[model samples]
Target: MLDHFENDMVVINDDANSDSVQTDDSSRLTTVENPTLITTTNHQVVKLQLNATSSSHTKCCVCRENLRDHAVKITFQDRDFIFLSRNIWIPEVARCCSGHLINNLLSKEAVDQNKPFSIRYQELSSSDVQLLLRKAQTLIEMARKDLVSMIQEILMMMNVVY
Candidate 1:
């Protein structure tokens, strides 16, 4: 998810092992500094550096999955108007495989937060009301036709067998 910070600082936590990068929001300009190496508890810190001028290589920021064909690019905008009027420049790319997982996690989080309940209730209630009305109208029309047929049968019987 995209997060806005004070002083035009925007931090995007893409995946578990991706490092946060700073960028200018408006112009989409990025400055690549030397990769800072740090040791982690579980995995070794392999410093993967990207040259400032390279293009057309796709990789998921979160899972580091190779995105050869389909990818998602997220752009963040600065929230605080005092910092700058432009959006943040951090561009994130995610592969099709891990993108679904990330989206599911986000959806699960929203459901856990009770966000889906309100939306679901509204949609279900409206459809249910419509269905109930249609059923009732159909029943009424059937009843009316049955009564008309009965009356017609009585009239025919009275005129016959004289």
Candidate 2:
């Protein structure tokens, strides 16, 4: 029999074994293979526990360290030189031991925004300089073609009958 009490524990009366299960506030009972458990509230005190497993170790891509429960979601930018574009990724990362994000990627504007839960940023990588050069070449070629077409259009307009 399961008795729902006003406390944070569930009283179990096993008739088959005739055992008396005594649960205390200090000890917690959890089912195997899952972190989330059934939680109950008593006197406005919510009791909940998350079981940590081997897979629970979340690593930060920048620092390559395991993350803890208290973490912030940070936005990271990746510039691929071959693609001529920038990519943004928002990931939940753990703060470093120095109490700062890895590589100091967090921007000043993000700090001024005062959103402790989330931070946004954009960064220009060194490799993207090559991509910018390529983009500039493409733009120059397009402009040269546009200028030739405009000159041809003006010549034909002047030759037309009034």
Candidate 3:
């Protein structure tokens, strides 16, 4: 009787093992093999740096004109990170002009004709700045995932089982 029970247990364990292997296989099938690699070539990095530095000279989104002389300057910090590698990217948007004043003027002209002259400057709130940082982080995460997946696929192709 004990021998029969032991045999049953062994069958049960084998069934469980098979089920787990099937589950793992199905899960792996859902993942794309050798996903596209994220390339950060030196030229791309230089382009990004140039864009960051020249953002101030770009036309203001609201006014569609080059920044005025002596325009109030605003700065925002952006960050990026990769998971497969230990690289941190922190880019700065410098000397950008705020457009809130022009918006306010237009709105006030429509609402009250005799209002005192006043201008509002649109400044990035702490939360808005945080959002920018979060975006960078997300990009980095995507790059990292792509890199890790590519490395994994390469290892598999080499018959590396780990």
Candidate 4:
């Protein structure tokens, strides 16, 4: 198992008490050809998908267990948030056990359990970056609306009490 990856891979296996990484040379790295898969380098994640689940997913990417009929697609916000907060990169099309998610999103425990099994060279696409930007924009819009509504409610209360 480890023999195959020893050539062009960096494998990291981490437990609660210890962390181990093995690499022959960082400079000579091979590209992951699967367009729908996720890989991580030390600094960043590459090829993150921002939309729709892939039907080809048969196992949970996190647990690697044979998925039942109830497997759910991970959301883009949860995927990006994990990468942002924990540096755990999830494939855009990765599916997971329904138990791993709360309301179709990755939970703190789920993110914590997600460690980079293999390290591949980073490759970012323009569409991936643009999709991330769009997700951020949508979040900002929602936040702005919430703030306005909260402020309006406060003003109403103040006027009524005055």
Highest TM-score against the true fold, candidate: 4
Which clashing pairs does model 4 show? none
For candidate 1, lDDT tens digit of each residue in 83-106? 122211122221222343354332
- Model 3 error, position 85 (Å): 15
RMSD value for candidate 3: 23.2
Give per-model TM-scores: 0.23, 0.24, 0.27, 0.44
Error of 2 at 143 (Å): 1.5
Candidate 2 residue runs with Cα over 4 Å from true position: 1-121, 160-162
Q: State how far residue 98 of model 1 sits from its true place (Å).
A: 50
Residue lDDT tens for model 2, 4-72 = 223444444334433334444564532222223333233222222211112113643334457666444
Error of model 3, residue 131, in angstroms: 0.4
Off by over 4 Å in 1: 1-124, 160-162
Candidate 4 residue 123 Cα shift, in angstroms, is 2.6
lDDT of candidates 1 onward, in order: 0.34, 0.38, 0.33, 0.60
The candidate with the higher TM-score, 2 or 3, is 3
| Candidate 2 C-alpha error for residue 110, in Å | 26
Q: Candidate 4's residue-wise lDDT over 1-162, tens digit each? A: 011222234333333343333333564443334444333443322443322222237977667778998888888677777665555666667788889888777777877776665543445654455676776677678889999888889989889541
Worst 10 residues of 4 by lDDT: 1-10
| Deviating ranges (above 4 Å) for candidate 3 | 1-123
| Stronger candidate by TM-score (2 vs 4) | 4
Clashes of 2: 0
Note the residue pairs that clash in candidate 2. none
